[model samples]
Target: MTEDASPRALITGGSRGIGRALAAAFAADGYDLVLVARNEERLEAVARELECGYGVDVTTVSADLTDPDALEEVYERATAGGAVDVLVNNAAVAVYGPVAETDLEAERDQVRLNVAAPVELTKRFLPAMLERDSGHVVTVASTAGMRPGPFLAGYHASKAYLISFSEGLTEELRGTGVDATVVCPGPVLTGIHERSGRGSRWLERRFMRSPDAVAADSYEGIRAGKAVVVPGLRFRLLPWVSRLLPRPLSRRLARLIIDRGDPLESDR
Candidate 1:
């Protein structure tokens, strides 16, 4: 779709945080919106706010993306007959604590939401985009994807798969008139911490970027067809520095950054 085209954007997890910010940004840019999330009430509120603020069409689909059937329905609801022009795969789950102690089902759900859903949704929408020869796919991966994370193993792995998938898709769509951008954001001030049972105001205040800033950069980068969008300069440096350091040293550094609580004391 060209600049003049009135594109439609589908954003998963659009009820809050970066997804919600992106929805508002796109609406202001004159795009019709399909906002997806598990919370129907919040989705409706966001939809109402966007429509009222930007005077654009907005639709909300409430479905658990971890479920394959629900994900299929979400894809159909958002992109029926090739109407969608931009896809933001932002839905994710974060399960903290040790891998052995963590709930296996929760870890599996993270994979289902963060990895499988995005791939499946892309598979469903890619053909239409190829046929039309125009569209953008933005996957909200994370800097955690650049290396293995000790405390957030499952979450990191899921984002790593997204990063690799998006990178590969960018290569395949080289001449297909479709573009994919993967956003690797570092710590951001969002409800994810609370949702994952890792809420810490002090930690967030010290280390996270504002959700608004991350959303703005992501929207601009995706619209400009950039392949990999790393928002902050600090995070942009992390991947390179991690590559330079030895694996063991890099892992220790990651643990220092991502691990919360008193380091001198045991987690218990």
Candidate 2:
């Protein structure tokens, strides 16, 4: 905590979508922000908007999270302001298509950004929060983590790791002033689908939880000290649906969608 009593939050991929939505939530709560993203122009725009709208200081860090060197720089910049009160691990990438045919380099980059970067950032910032005995770590994962998605294998696996990691941290940090929460949103209207080159309209219709809704739900869960927070009423039934169908049926249905239906076809 800073002497000024203003809390600070550091969010990766804060320029758009869920990251941007969460940023608004934090800013509204009067937390100064450090918004990080690869696009300098977009990051600065978001920073300016939040500062203007919420009347809180905003710092923009433009760097690629997948790059280790850039991450160190991000740490320096984020802490220069003060100890971060909230750390949002919201940046992630989805690599679609058959695993064998996907670009190996892209897949690795996704893993580095989606899985390794959050761990690295937490390692850098979480200890200080623990020492102070006050902070929150919110990961924006997905409901896809609960079940297999054939065309989105890497993305689904990465989200599962996030869910597991956050849930474990939630248990480990109990009684400590810090808490860990993973927000699982099924699908939203976002550039992620287009960027992944696989916007499945059929899937999106199943759960239309907006990024803002996810952020709100995340806050509710975090305040309640919940380990896992699945936003959207419709999406919350996902596990039930997955369980009712046998594993074979669930997998086969996914295969049908990816094969005959081609869920990878971007409706965007």
In model 2, which range of ten residues has the least summed lDDT?
259-268
- What residue runs in model 2 are displaced by over 4 Å at the alpha carbon? 257-268
lDDT of 2 by residue, 78-171 (tens): 9988889999999998888899899999999999999999999988999999999999888889888887878888888899899899989889
Best by TM-score: 2
- Of candidate 1, the 10-residue stretch with the lowest lDDT total is 259-268
How would you encode candidate 1's per-residue C-alpha lDDT over 1-268 as one tens digit per residue?
4566578999999998889988888998999999999999999988999999999889889999989999889877776633898889998889987898889999889999999999998988878888889888889999889988887889888999999999999999998889999999987777575567755445545777777889888878887899999997767897798689999998887687667542121110
Alpha-carbon local distance difference test for all models: 0.84, 0.84
Could you tell me the lDDT of residue 190 within candidate 2? 57
Assess the local accuracy of residue 108 in candidate 2 as a C-alpha lDDT between 0 and 100: 98
RMSD of each: 4.0, 2.4
